[model samples]
Target: MSEKVVLHYFNGRGKMESIRWLLAAAGVEFKEEFLTKREHYVKLLDDGALMFQQVPLVEIDGMQLVQSRAIMNYIAGKYNLYGKDLKERALIDMYTEGIIDLLDIIMLWTIETPENKQKQLSNIEQKAKERFLPVFEKGLANSDFLVGNQLSRADVHLLEATLTLQEIFPTILSTFPKIQAFQERMKALPRISKFLQPGSARKPPTDEVYVKTVKEVFSHIFK
Candidate 1:
C-alpha cells in the first residue's frame, strides 16, 4: 500500500512551503488539510491535536508530527535529502537554522501595526545586509547548493526563505550575486519549476486577505 500523508496548515504557504516542496520534489502524494477558518484552527488547538499549538502539522505513516523544521527533517531523512554522512548533515543543519533565522525576520512583517511594520522592514534590511544574506552568499561562494555539492534540505529551505523575502522586498538580493544566482538555479530544477508554475499551490499570500488573515492568526504572538 502507498504511504498515507496528510499535511495540516493554514491556507497560505507561510512556514509549510519548504515541507510541501520536499514532498513535491520527492514525488510523494499527500493530502493537504488547510484550515481556512479561524474557529477550525482554534478547535484543533483545543482538541489537543496540535501539541505545540502551531500549524504545518503532518500526519504520516501512522505518526503525527508538529513543528515545520522537525517535519521537514523527517521527510528529508526519508527522501535522502538530509546529507550523505554526519559532517555533511551537521553543515546542512547549520544552513537550515540560518535560513529559519531569516524566516523569523520575514514573518515579523506580517504584523499589521504601522510601527511594527516599519520596524520589521528596517530589521529585514539590516539583518539581510549584515547577517543572513552575507552568510548565504559566502556559503554559496564555493557551490550552488548551501550544504554539500548536492541539493540538500538546506537548499530547499534557503529557496523558500529567499522567495519569501523577495515577495516583500523585491530588490533585496540585487547586491548578493551568488545568492541571486543560487535562487535562479534552484527554481530551474524540474520538480521545483513545476511546483512554481502559474496557479500552483506553492504561491505565497499576495492579496489583502492574506495580510488580514496573518494578522488575525498571529495576533497573540505579535502582541
Candidate 2:
C-alpha cells in the first residue's frame, strides 16, 4: 500500500520549494501539480479538490492537508525526520520557527512597494534581521543539526529558506558567518545537492540588484 502525496505549487519561489526538497530528500513518492493565478485555484475550489483552498497541500492516503509548515511537520513525522529526543525536537522546532520569522519579513518585503519597501527596510526589517541572526548563528554553532545531532526535517526547511533568502535578501546574511557556513554545509548534502541542479525553473528575485548584492555579500562572508 503505497501512500499518495500531491504538492500544489505556483510559479517561482515560495513555500512549495521547501516541501519539494523535504519530500525529495526523503525519497518520498509524490506528484507535483502547479496552479496558475487566474482560474486554476478557482477550478480546484469549485471541485473541492483543494480542501483547504490553499497551495502546497499534500494528500497522504486520502487525507488532504493545507498550510506549508504543518505539511512539512507531517512529512517529517511520517518519515522519522523529527529529532531523536524531546529536547532535540524542541530545538529543531525552535530554530525552524525562528527561521520562519525571518522568511516572513523577507516575503513581506518582496511584495512591498518601492517607497514603503525602504520604509520597511529601515523601520522594521533592518532591525528584525539583526535580531534573528544571532539566534540562527547560535543554533548552527550549538550543533551539527538544528533539531538533532543528525540531519532532520528542520534543517531541510531552514536550509532551503536560507538558500532562497541568500538570493532574495543577501544583506541579512552578510555578517552571519555561522549561518553562511550552515548554508554551505546543508547545500553540500547528497540529497540536498540534487536541488541545485540546473533547470529547476525556480523564480528569480524581482530585484536583480538585490540578488546580486546579496550573492556578493555571501561570498565575502564565506571568504
Candidate 3:
C-alpha cells in the first residue's frame, strides 16, 4: 500500500485511461509512463513486462497487471469500490460491462480516416443515445449510486464513459439529466476533482498524432 501505482500507455486516452480514472477515484496515487515511440513499447515487450504483449500495463501491489478489465477489478476490490456482497457485486459488474461496451465504440474512432471520422462519430452518438445512455439513466433514476447506496467502480466507469462521449459532442448528455447530475456529483469528489483539473494525468481525446504513434508502435496489428 505504501508503493505508488505505475501505469504504462500512450500519451493519449486509450484503455489505460479508464484505469487512470479508477485509480484516481480510489484515491491511489499513480505515475504514468507514456509510450512515446516504438522503442518504449519494444523495451517493455523485451523485458517481459507485458503479459499479453499489450500496453495499459500496470504495476501495483508487486504485480504487473494487464487487461483493463482485470486491472480495474483489482483496483475496485482493493479500494472497496466493489459492493459488499456477492449479489451487489454482480449488479455492479452488469452495469460496468455495459459502460465498457459503449467505450469500445469510442475507441474505434481513433482509427477512423479523416473522411470517416464524422460518420463514425455519428454512429457512436447513435449507439450512446439509443443503446447505452438510456440504461444508465434508468439505473440512476432513484439513487445516487448505480448498484447500491454507495459509490462503486460502476459509478466511476459510467462517469468516465459519458465524459469521453461528451468530448466529441458537448450536448450528448443534455437529454439525460440524471446522468448529467451523476457526472457532476462524481466530479465533485475531492480526489476526482483533482484528477479533472488541467495538467493532470487525464489525457485528452486521441488525435491524429496519437493515432499515428499507436499504429507505428503496433504496426503489426493495425495492418
Candidate 4:
C-alpha cells in the first residue's frame, strides 16, 4: 500500500523540519504544503477540515496527525528509527525530550512581544544555559550521537533543534563547544547535509528576525 504524508509547515524550518528530515530519511514520498503565517495555516486547516490548531500537522492516508514530535514518533516507529533495543529507545526519548525543553525556552523569547522579550531572554539565560546546557553538553560528550552511535530519531531531532540555535542561541552553544561541534557533525551527515544546502526552506520572517535579535542580545549578556 502506498502512504501519503502531507506536512503543513511555514516557510522556514521549525518543528516540521525534523519530520521532513525523517520522511526523507525513510525514503517516504510526501508533499510539503508550506503556509505563510499562522492565519494561512489556520485557513488550511479550515479548508481541509483539519481539527488541529497548529501547523506541522501530517496527514497520512485518510488520518490526520497533530503536533510535530508526535508525527516524528509515529513515522519513526513505522520505520524502526527508534532503535532495536528497549534501552536504546528509552535513550532516544531522553535526548528528544531534552531537545524539546531547549526549544521551549528558545521559543519563549521568539514568541513573546518586543517589550517583554528581553525579560524572557533573561529567564532562558538564567535557567536554561546555566542549568541545562552543561548537562546536555555532558551527554553529547558521552556519545558521538545523542543516544547510540547509530543515527536514531533522537539524533535527527537534536540536529533539527540545534539548527534553531543559529537563530536563537548561537553564543550559548559557543560557550559549550561540544554541543557546537555536535551540531556541525549532524549537519555533516549525508541525509542532513541535503537540508543544509543553500536555499533550503526557512522559518517565517517574524520568527526568524525575532529569534536572531534575541540571540544577539543573549550573546552579549551571557558572554
Candidate 5:
C-alpha cells in the first residue's frame, strides 16, 4: 500500500527526513504534500502557514507547525520518545543534536560541486568513522538505547543517522560493532521494521534528478 505522509516539504531528505523517521518509529500514519513547484511553496507563504518560511512544515492536530527541529521535538515528545524525566530529555537533546550534525552534511552533499563532492564524501567518512559513530558506539556500549536504557528520541535520531550513513557509505559501520547491533535491534522494532520495508513513505537518496528538481523548485533559497 502507498504511504500517505502529512507534511510540507520537497520530496527529498532535507530536514523532513527526521520527522518522517520519528513518525514512522511511532507507527503514526500521516500524509505529506510535496512542494515540487514554486506555486506549492508560494501557497504556504500565501496562507501564512510557514512561521519561518521554510519547511518541513507539518500539519497535525489542526496546527501548522514549521521548523524542522521544533517539529521533531514536538513529535518525539508526543510519541513518548522524548524521555521519562527532564535530565533524560536533556541528554536526548544533546545526543540528537550531534546526530543532526552528521545528517546535515549528508543532506548538503547533493548541492556540492563536482570538485567538492569527493572531498565532502571523504570528510563525511572520516567524521562518521572518527567522531560521530564512535560517540554513539560508546553510548550504546552499556545500553541498547543512547539514553535512559530505553528507546528515546536520541536513539531514533541516531538510528536514522546510521541508516543515512550506510546508504552513502555502506561499510561505514564495519568497526562499530555496537552500532551494527544497534541497527539490527532498532530495525527489529515492529514500527521501524515496517518503515524499513519497500513501498514505505521513506524518501530516496538525493540524486541528479532530485537535485535538479530542487534547484528549480527552490532557486531562490538554493542560490
Candidate 6:
C-alpha cells in the first residue's frame, strides 16, 4: 500500500519545524512542497485548498490537513507519538500547548520593522527568562521527557521551540539547566540528529539581523 503524505509550507521552517520533526522521528516518508512565492500561496487560497488561509497544510492519503497542531496531532496519532493512552495524551497536549505559547512570542520577532522587531526580541528575552523558562524547568525537574519516559509530540514541540529561541537568544536557556539537558538529549536521537545536520531542509534560515540585534540587546547577559 502506497501512502502519500505531502506537506505544504513556506521555504523556511517557521511553523512547520515541529511537524517536520514529528514526521522524521516517526520515520515517515513525505514530500515537501515549498510555497516559496506569495503567488504560490495565493493560488492555493484562491483555489480554496487552504481552509484556514494558512500554510503548513499537510495532504495525507488524499485528505488535506490544515493547522500545524492538528497536522502534528494526526501524524502523532498515526505514529503513536501522541501518548500511550488518554491520560498521557492529555498531559502531552498541556505541555505542547505551553510550549506553543512561548513559540508565539518568539515568532513576533519576525516583524519586518526594526523597532517592532527589537521590541519583540526584548519581550521574548524577558518572557523566556521570567515566565517560560521556570515552567519548563519545574516540569522537567524529574523526567527526561515531557510526558513519559519515551519521546512524545510534546517533547518534539518543545525541542523545536527551544531551538527557535536559541537562534535569536543564544544564551537564553543557560539558566534552565534541565531544558538545556533535555535539548541535548533530543538532538542526540538518531533520527532527529540527522534532520538537524547542516544543509537539512528542516533547519530554519538564520536571520542575521535578528541575531545581531538580540546580541546587542542582551549583551549584559552574554558578557
Candidate with top TM-score is 3
The reply for model 6, stretches above 4 Å from the true place, is 206-223
| Candidate 6 TM-score versus the reference | 0.85
Angstrom error at residue 57, model 5? 0.5
Clashing pairs in 6: none
Per-model TM against the reference: 0.86, 0.78, 0.95, 0.75, 0.94, 0.85
Worst 10 residues of 6 by lDDT: 210-219
> Tens-digit lDDT track for model 4 on 97-172?
8877877667555656778887776687666567667776888887777667777887776666666665655666
lDDT of 2 by residue, 29-74 (tens): 6766666443656666786766566666667767778888888888
Order of models, best lDDT first? 3, 5, 1, 6, 4, 2
List, residue by residue over 1-223, the lDDT tens digit for candidate 6.
Answer: 1267888775555677778888988888778877645566678888788897776788886678899888888999999898898999999998888888887766655634677777677877898889777888888999998887788988888888888888888988888999999999999998888888886658565465534444443345447
Model 1 C-alpha lDDT per residue in residues 1-223, reported as the tens digit of each score: 2267987776666788778888877768787877776776788788787998888788887777898888988999999898999999999999888888887766656644677787678778788778888888999998878877788988888888888888878888999999989989988898888878886668565455766775676577646
- For model 4, the run of ten residues with the poorest summed lDDT: 213-222
Clashes of 2: 0
RMSD of 5: 2.7
lDDT of each: 0.80, 0.68, 0.90, 0.69, 0.86, 0.79
Tens digit per residue, CA lDDT, model 3, 1-223: 3267888898888888889998898888888788888899999999999989987899999999998999999999999999999999999999999988888888887778878877797788898999999999999999999988999999999989988888888999989999999988999999989999999888888888998989999988879
Better candidate number, 2 or 5, judged by TM-score: 5
- For lDDT, the strongest prediction is 3
Candidate 4: RMSD to truth? 7.2
- Residue 118 in candidate 2, Cα distance off native in Å: 3.2
Q: Count the backbone clashes (under 3 Å) in each candidate.
A: 0, 0, 0, 5, 7, 0
Q: What is candidate 3's CA lDDT for residue 14?
A: 80
Q: Show where candidate 2 strays beyond 4 Å.
A: 1-4, 123-125, 169-174, 201-203, 206-223
TM-score of 2: 0.78
